[model samples]
Target chain A: MSKEFFTIGALLYKDYDLIDVNATLRLLGSLKDNFNIITITQTGEHVKSYTPQVANYINYNFENCPDFDILFIPGGIGTKYELENPVFLDFIKERAPRVKYVLTVCTGSGLVAKTGLLDGKKATTNKQFWDWMTSNGPNVLWVKKARWVVDGKFYTSSGVSAGMDMALGFISDVFGREAADEIAITAEYEWHDNPHWDPFAERIFGKNI
Target chain B: MSKEFFTIGALLYKDYDLIDVNATLRLLGSLKDNFNIITITQTGEHVKSYTPQVANYINYNFENCPDFDILFIPGGIGTKYELENPVFLDFIKERAPRVKYVLTVCTGSGLVAKTGLLDGKKATTNKQFWDWMTSNGPNVLWVKKARWVVDGKFYTSSGVSAGMDMALGFISDVFGREAADEIAITAEYEWHDNPHWDPFAERIFGKNI
Candidate 1:
């Protein structure tokens, strides 16, 4: 209702990779004037991360989430477990169509794929856990040689640190290249702008799919 | 004292930059088998970050802090306020000399410089806030062209995300380049092994110092 800043719903769960989650948050939050992020979870209670860092509280729960322009899902070791959760899958099923953009980092793409949202889309997941991640979405056109993949409204990135690069890319798409460049410059990050500049994929898989 | 993993005391306070703090934690935590991290704060209370993310609890207070091999300090807008706090400065002054390594990310280097440990020692800080960050330590040799700077046991990085690079550099120095490379490969990160590859310094200042 308030057209102030673009609202982003950052979904968090137990054992979520803290780096992937926080890197995306920090980059998006840096553009606070252009974006307002709310940490969302299945429950509003404390969420513990794979790093064992505990967040005292989350902003919203699944039952009472607000309307958001974008949905940000980050991956962790927990993704293997979360993918099998019916409630989590249902939440993605319900919300994926509502949001204008769907952004997934690391194996978070695997969770999105499980909802069948990424079935016909070009997406990517963390290269480190290539086999486990790729095994989930048989119908998805998985990009093996990408730092990130962009297909329509979906943006999926490679791994833990790659999420920052994808967030910058999303910023460039939504705002402008200049805005994204400024954010990266401010953070002192070398934005690997080329989506296909993924050496990890080649190193691990021996080829870029 | 356990000779197993290197112990790092991660200093925390209100409004500390979540990106800087978490990036360092996630990278270091990935090597948990080789490093034991404890979040230290002024009080044992939950410290809220600039992102408003609350850390559930802190490990130790300043007075009761244990001996650590390395001291980790992160920076945020809170750095502007924390710089003037005598207790914070005193804590740094006391612990810095005792620790084998002092790691400062973003404006955290400015805090370290304030304690005079970095006086006459070469270091760096967040490049976006270059002037203000460098203004504090007149005697410190500041490297304007660096993703991260290493002078003796002190490792200081450029900005929020540059901390990740510095952490990898630290990992390389401590555990060997192979170990750092393995960690980077595992996280699927392009480890910018060369510290001088700082495009931000050149873009912002028109030259690398």
Candidate 2:
């Protein structure tokens, strides 16, 4: 509607991981005029992060949130409660299929998994909570040694800050490698462009687990 | 205080850089129990980020903000106006001397420079806005080839995400390298440990410039 900007709906809940949410959005927001990022919460108010006592002001409730091209879900300790929420799951289940892209950071995949959207989908999540997340979707093809896994419109990534790298990769996918590289360079961030360049899997899950 | 947590006073204005503020805080916040981060705004209400329309709820105002162990300043388009505001400059000038560490990301160094806090000290700023930031600090010695510059308590980093590397370096300085490494691994982020490992200098500004 406004220019040709793609609307990105960023869902928030109590105790949501701050870094997981911001890191990804920073890259997307870098293309400012090309993207419109909005904060979505159940109450359409403010929600505190998992730690450090940071809060984000929400712009929309699930019922009133405008149609978005991309749907973003970030994971945190609050996700333990959110995963069981029928309203949360139902909202995602109903909206995700209609979105152009659905992205989940960290254990956010588990939230999507609970909605049955990630069933039979290839995905990867925060390695720290690997067992819990993988078990949530028994039918989903879980890849361990991946920074992120992209299957069709569903893009799932590893832990908190890993979302930034995955966002850059997503940018590379939709835009070009040059555009992604330019953003990373402008931000003075090193782009781990290779999706297979994950050392945390073996380091966290042990040699063979 | 509650436990042995170090307090961080984060200054916010109308259009502060979001990534520059959040990236460093994410790393420091990872060690949640050890640090207490507080947002300080002009009116103790909320501040918007320079981006795709985002905002942050504030914790304290300039008049009520408590003593902090570390003082953090981030740059943005709003900084163009903040540089001339005496209240902003006066607060930083007064508090910076008593703080254990003063970290400035990107053109945030320009704000500190205007306060004369960084005068005759080694500092760095965003490569893209190098000329503008350096011009603000006539007496400050600016380094071109640095991911970050640490001259005493002042940690002035290159740009947005370079603040994360500086934060890790600060962690290694305060805690230990092992602790910083552990945090990095947990976040699934690659830490650029070396303070002088900045390729952006040569990239943004050609060699022999």
lDDT of 2 at A192: 86
For model 1, the docking class works out as medium
Per-model CA lDDT versus the true structure: 0.83, 0.86
In the order shown, the candidates' DockQ scores are 0.53, 0.73
Worst 10 residues of 2 chain A by lDDT: A1-10
TM-score of 1: 0.91
- The DockQ of predicted model 2 stands at 0.73
Model 2 residue runs over 4 Å out of place are A1-4, A205-209, B1-4, B206-209
Query: Per-residue lDDT tens digits of candidate 1, residues B120-207?
Result: 9999888888899998899999999988999999999988888888888888777778878887887778888888888878878896
Best by TM-score: 2
Q: Model 1: residues >4 Å from true position, as ranges?
A: A1-4, A52-57, A207-209, B1-4, B44-47, B52-67
lDDT of 2 by residue, A1-209 (tens): 12456889999999898778877898888888789889999878788886687777688998889999999999888899988888988889888988999999998999998887888889999898899988889989899988888999999999888889899998888877888998999888888888887889989767775
Which digits, one per residue and each the tens of the lDDT, describe model 2 over residues B1-209? 12556889988888887778877787888778899888998778687787677877688998998899999998777889898898988989889999988998988999999888888899999898898889998999999989999999999998888888988998888878888999888788888899888888988777754
